[model samples]
Target: MTVTEAEGDTAAQAPMGSSSYSRFDTDWLSDATLALFATGGTSPLFATSSTVEVRYLGTQATREASLSFQGPALFDTRSGCNFATALVDEFCLIDSIGTARTLGDLATGTTLDFTLTAQPQPLGSPIDQRASAESFSSLASARWIDLGGGQYLLGFEEGNDASYNDMVFLVSGATATLPSPALPVPELPTGWLLAAGLAALAWRHHTRR
Candidate 1:
């Protein structure tokens, strides 16, 4: 889905570094919080430095998921930046929380592609599902959020539930350029707007029950 900017002279572009929206509650991290472009298309993350750090934030899914990267210099064995050494073949694991890994020798200003795979549990189907940043086959499986300062939040939706909170990670030294259009900022704090949206969702869910 394309996110278009507003028309007319009053439309202002979001700042380059920080997200257009406000900070989300920490509790939302444990649950399926709203993502800026949850149902829309995502852009590739570009490396800002020769080396980028990826930290496992946390996962709320029951599936055994693994995160991997694919890029021009990522798996090049000749550059000594092979998948096994330069990049962690399995950078983040479902059970390995709060762990961080560095991807070295990445070419600056280039896209760093990512793939998230969800392993089948004993009780679930035996098929392994995959989501990719460069592929549109599973567009809803992955979501990217700019957290400013060359940091981004990447989330994946492993199951059909549409909760992109299955696997969440923080990537530093990388940036993603979204195609969203400029929006008019209201007088209220951006955080309050985000909170109000969440409150509405919660209230709707509560009433349904």
Candidate 2:
């Protein structure tokens, strides 16, 4: 997932290392499950870093899907930045029409096509002397929760804290959509450099507490 400027601008052409976007695709492993493909990318001057992961617990079949994001970086070195990792300015979820949709049931092994996007709050001011301050979604993971009927809950990781209250999506029928809520593009100081590798593999550390 390479970082790109808002409004379909790539990071290479951006004026400064601020907001960006990326897109990824994955497949469905179950009737009610969508494997959120893992991806990681960096911005110029290493100003922003991002990683995502989603998987299923059981077996099933489906087709390829896509997800996108349009917001500031989640990991930043500017603690004093304005919109850095604020959530309110960021948003990410299954991108679809309307507010809600359905995905049938998992027990029946009914696969469906869909798309999801992850967005964070708007970009904040550049980092200041507060270099020690760091903001990040290290635990940016997601899972599916059965809500009975054709509705399902899509939960995502949030904050540095070990909590699952970050974001949720409800699928009611064959389609599922989530409202763009407040997302934060937190700024964090650089410390240990993560070993470079595949996008999905590089982000495993971010999942750890």
- Give each model a TM-score: 0.49, 0.24
As a whole number from 0 to 100, the lDDT of residue 23 in candidate 2 is: 14
lDDT of 1 by residue, 1-209 (tens): 11122221211111111221111224224223344436523767777767777665554443344566652211110121111221243222222334456777666665666666554444323332233222212243677777679877777666666656555666788866532434777598889999999999999999999
Q: lDDT for every model?
A: 0.49, 0.26
Model 1's TM-score against the true structure: 0.49
The pairs that clash in candidate 1 are 5-181
- Candidate 2 is scored at a TM of 0.24
Off by over 4 Å in 1: 1-41, 71-95, 124-140, 178-209
At residue 37, candidate 1 shows an lDDT of: 32
lDDT of 2 by residue, 54-94 (tens): 22111111111122223322121112112232233332222
Model 2 misplacement above 4 A: 1-98, 101-140, 174-209
Best candidate, TM-score: 1
